[model samples]
Target: MPDFSKLYDDLKRARDEIKLKIHLGSKDAQDEWAELERRWATFENKAELERSAKDVSDAVKILGSELKDAFQRVRKAL
Candidate 1:
């Protein structure tokens, strides 16, 4: 099993740090933040499902991949 907790924390920390540096008044920044929020929500929802999951479903596998991709994108953005 992967260490989802650590990935989640790292992505969140990166997002928060970037949030502090960007101007809220900028539409571009707000759009970027919105994308981050969307990714975070998806990742968090999947993580919750993973906790209660018995067998690893195809959907879960896809979600895991997506979350990892999102994390990488955010990391690169930072």
Candidate 2:
């Protein structure tokens, strides 16, 4: 059988990293929003692009979390 414990630990670490990146990205986005507003005084397509990018980033983080949870379950099963 596979080394499920090791797999779980690895997946958990990956999930943590994803979470950290998401947090950092969020802060960066806030800064970006401030800069955009200061420069333009109004919203525009760039904001939409940022939102879309953030959505994709969040989706990846969620997927990573789900994968880690699935791996943990499999580890338990094994």
For model 1, the stretches where C-alpha displacement exceeds 4 angstroms are 54-78
lDDT of 1 by residue, 1-78 (tens): 567768877887987888787775589878887897898899888888886683557678999999999999999999
How does each model score on lDDT?
0.81, 0.66
Q: Which stretches of candidate 2 lie over 4 Å from their true place?
A: 1-43
| Residues 31-59, model 2: lDDT tens digits | 76457446543333455566678789999
Give residue 36's lDDT in candidate 1 (0 to 100). Answer: 77
Clashes of each: 0, 0
